[model samples]
Target chain A: MKDIWKKFDETEPSHSSIHHLMAVYHLHKKNGYARGIDIANYLNITRGSVSITLTKLRDKNYLTEDENKFYHLTEQGQQLVNSALSKRHIVKRFFSEVLQLPAEVAELDACKIEHLLSNETGEKLICFMGYYLSEKPEVLNFRLGFRQFKYQCQSVAECRLCESDCFFSGKEISKTG
Target chain B: MKDIWKKFDETEPSHSSIHHLMAVYHLHKKNGYARGIDIANYLNITRGSVSITLTKLRDKNYLTEDENKFYHLTEQGQQLVNSALSKRHIVKRFFSEVLQLPAEVAELDACKIEHLLSNETGEKLICFMGYYLSEKPEVLNFRLGFRQFKYQCQSVAECRLCESDCFFSGKEISKTG
Candidate 1:
């Protein structure tokens, strides 16, 4: 584990690099092209700072500039973004489906977690979610159910019809049981 | 999501700091006290390098030195280590109990994951595991069952009597189904 962290520290790009990659992704998604200024503006940093980072990224072969002077992610960059996004999806599913967090909260948490979770744990999460959902598809439904239940119920005791049906009820019982 | 990553970058300590905290933790656990040489030997780094990082940790107030020159983690340091270790526990449980990975692999993965997982995702994983386990205690049983079954069965097709009773059989069918 110590060696793994050290290797990650040595090889993995900094948070700013990830931020740049994501900024490029979001900028491209928004405007169909990512410009250096667009990345800077999106990140709330200076254009010169973005340019420096972009230059480093290009030197590292993670980005390229076209004839139109628009920034684009290379295959390596795309893979890095895709891998991070994949981890986010697994974590978001765990949050929304398994823990029944709100969609927005799940999305936000996933973004934070994607960078932090190891590849092994990320793959395990994907497998576990697949296995758990196969066994209990209702867990996937818990997101919508939780929202509706939260809106309807003033308190747990008030939901008389939801005694056995409510997802959170089981959790409450488990705490005491 | 972007803001969260930026915030973590600004506030979170470097990887070396985390490594030092972990070294101190392990040394204290193994020897009842941590010293500079112990940290250096444990990390396979020079005592000078250890001193530099430890000085930074001390400046950051993560460690304290006693009159006997033994090192100890401060409350804040203990909290940080505990939090990271807690994340490891959740990931390890998911790998071993949910995905049925080997114990050593799970441990290694957990150690790697502990550093990567966000607090939000860590908390959610804890809740998800609790909820999932409460709903299906068989997942816990599957851990032990898998070890025994792994020793007995040569391959998936070789398990005759273990068809429906096998833990991973359902997972395999689910994958193809």
Candidate 2:
């Protein structure tokens, strides 16, 4: 299956556009609808900036402004946000559940990554996280290992605590180094 | 650990800037050096655009351009590229080895994700892949399941092919849906 669009070179969604889309989607979820000022306030951007991007989104057929001036995503826009939302869910879960990152860190990391990962990569990652969380019993050990990892991974020459069997061991690196 | 930078609302590297940084790093790796016109040719961008971004990278202390017009990443730039390169290695391995995605697809996906994933998530993912690849024999079946998942995940409704065992099944979603 060749996927030229997967490169997303020319057709890539802008960061701000995707950000605004998610903001609009969440606002709709909370208030049952969204508008320009609502999105601006939610995203902490100026209303004029929101209006400009929303107009672009509308021109691209991703959204429509109703008679009441409430914003609604078109079907295409809904699909876009749904995919992003699902990916964000998986990434956030992976960080929080498997890596033991704090929820806020997980959310921030997932938000940054949701736009960048390919669907295949996202699926595989979610699948792996599902298996890991369900099967693994050493959550505490893993969290401690992360602390150790943070300290020990700084240099190939300076690692002192990793076991000989550890994949990231300085001894292992020295053999190749 | 409060990571304010992860939000990347400000002070985030632009996509073009990251691309240029990687290009310069790769050029240095393969040819022992990099130059502006070489990067422009390699990335298929205009020399003017390359010059503009290279200046930004220099200002950020990620790289330096000599009087001879060759570009060299500083220590900080080298560290940045090394981290991104390692993450790309792990993501590509997971996609190709674990998920059975084609090598090209994996590479492209890895490139896109290399910039976005937090280091902590990358470390956990690499550890999981190491364990899964070394321990699991159901890898083939898992790949087939992914094919099925690809077909079945297009809609939240009418997803009956997934077994009840599947965490992503409609039944699972309906519990919350």
Task: List model 1 lDDT by residue over A88-115, tens digit each.
Answer: 7767777776665667767765665566
Per-model root-mean-square deviation over C-alphas: 10.9, 7.5
Model 2, A1-177: lDDT tens digits are 333223544435665687787777889889998988999888777999889899999999888999988988888787677666667777788667655677876888777767666655555655544443432334333433433332224444443322122333332221001
Model 1, stretches more than 4 Å misplaced? A101-105, A116-124, A131-177, B101-109, B115-124, B131-177
Classified by CAPRI criteria, candidate 2 counts as: incorrect
Write down the TM-score of model 1's second chain: 0.68
TM-score of each: 0.69, 0.72
Task: Say which candidate scores most in TM-score.
Answer: 2
Per-prediction share of native contacts kept: 0.11, 0.17
Q: Model 1: which residue pairs collide?
A: A116-B116
Worst 10 residues of 2 chain B by lDDT: B168-177
Q: How well is each residue in B1-177 modelled by candidate 2, as lDDT tens digits? A: 343323654435655676788789879878988998889877887899888889989999999988898999888787676666677777777678765667876888777667676665566665555443432334334433434342224334443322222334332221001
Per-prediction TM-score, chain B alone: 0.68, 0.71
Q: In model 2, which regions exceed 4 Å deviation?
A: A1-11, A126-177, B1-11, B135-177
